[model samples]
Target: MVKQERAARTRRALIQAAAEVFAEVGFVPASLGAISKRAGVSNGALHFHFASKAMLAEAIETEAAETVRRLTEAARARHGDSLQAVVDATHDLMGTLAKDIVVRGGFELAGDIARRTKSPLRKEWQRWIEDSLRRAGHSGELADQVPWADAARVIVAATVGLAVLGVKDATWLSRQNVTRFWELLLPRLTGRRDTGTLVSAGSRPPAAVPAPARSPRTPPAH
Candidate 1:
């Protein structure tokens, strides 16, 4: 049992270390030596746990996808019926992508891997997004018009593009702008405009205005 526990901890450390290295140097440029050094483990240990860099990359992709799946599921469970929930969930997903450099980098790596190799993780992510969209009431003729598969593709592609842009120009895709882009585009794709006035990029809606108080009536006092 102790051995198993130690192994699990080592594995976790390696994964965290790999995520950091990949985020910094990218999947292709990052080497096993750097990952092992980051994890404070021997190169042999990394090789023992993961056969090759491709395997490690796959693991990172799996971790990222699982993280997204959990967040999406939780959001749906909390706010499935409301359109705001859908919008909020989408924004939340983007926020996750933006905040976690490893997750963002892993997605780019997964795309590159898909082009060169048979990457099941990439396909899984695509399917998961499509499934989430369908569950969120984006379907039928509207689904046909937008096509959940195509919509998922566009959503992920846009995310990747935005992430790359942000990496190049830190201010290129601010969180506010990302939120607004989704708020505006989602309604068009879902054929639902439940959220009131789309908030502009970098600006939130103004606080609700209070009603004016009525004037007091004059009294006939001596």
Candidate 2:
């Protein structure tokens, strides 16, 4: 049991280290030795956990997909307006991409021409956007002029482009940048009256809320 627990910890550490290295440098150039060094694990330990760097990258992508899944699910649940939820999901996704090296690495890996396959992260995100837009159109949230297919393309392309750009400059993933994106699109996507209700930026997870203020208690008057 103890061995199993330690193996899990080592595997997690190696994955995180590989993510950091991959996010800094492309996968082709990232070395397993560097990952092991960063992970504070020996070469043998790394090999035991992951046979090769490609295996490590696959693990990173899996973990990143799981995180994105949670983001999509929670955003969908709390949002009464499907379009707004998609918009909010973009905000949350960019925030996660900015802070989580694993997610950033996964996205970068998906874009690698050598990989040849669609990224699970990209596909999952695209699926949610399409589903949400379809729901919005069905429920009359989308504006009369808004085309759901074109809207989905714009949303997916813009966010992917932003995520790619963010690889070089994290500012592209900032709340302000994401807000500007929504600011440009919301007017055309939703009725003007509904625009005021949707959050344009920094909409955190449904569970994220500002903490209440604490003040010193006053002594009771005797």
Candidate 3:
């Protein structure tokens, strides 16, 4: 049992270290030695946990996906207002992207055309947005003129763009930035009555917005 716990801890450390390295340098340039060293584990230990850099990157993506899944689920469960749920999720997503190393690395990997791995993180987010908007439309929460698909597309594009732009300027992921986006967009997307009730900045602030996840060039994580 002790050995199992220790192994799990080692794997977690390796994943975290790999995320840091991947975020600092693109996946193509990241080195196993650096990951192992940053993890404070021997090369052999890293090898025991992962066969190659690709495997480590996959682990990071998997962890990041789970984090987003939980985040979205919690957001949906927290708010009865479907639009509010999306607003809350976006705020949390940006929060995590700015604060979680695994998420940052995963998104970086997803955008790397050099890396052939297909990441589901963006798709998952888009699907959730689509579902939320669809629900809002059915419930009369959306404007009669607003098509859920179109709203989903716009939200996806804007969020993805923000994540990409945030790679150079983290300010793009700030809560205020997201709030401003919603402020402008919510009025157009929500029903007249709902618009008055929906908080464009999200129904609630995240519990805490941690320090930057990386030293520099922070983007929203996948």
Residue ranges of candidate 2 with Cα displaced over 4 Å: 191-193, 202-222
Better of 1 and 2 by TM-score: 2
Q: Is candidate 2 or candidate 3 better by lDDT?
A: 3
Arrange candidates by lDDT, highest first: which order? 3, 2, 1
lDDT of 1 by residue, 75-193 (tens): 55665543343444445555656566446656566556433765454465556566666654443423336666666677667755665565435454566767767766756665654
For all predicted structures, in order, the TM-scores are 0.69, 0.88, 0.89
lDDT of 2 by residue, 1-222 (tens): 866656767777787788889888888899999998888878888888789888998988888887888888877777854666787788888888887777898898878777676678888888888888888888888899888878888999999999989987999988888899899888888867578877787455424322122222221111
lDDT of 3 by residue, 32-125 (tens): 9998888888888888889999999998888788788888888888885478889898998888888787888888877888887678877788
Prediction 1 global C-alpha lDDT? 0.59
Clashing pairs for model 2 are: none
Model 3, poorest ten-residue lDDT window? 213-222
**Which should have the higher lDDT, number 1 or number 3?**
3
On TM-score, the leading prediction is 3
Off by over 4 Å in 3: 208-222
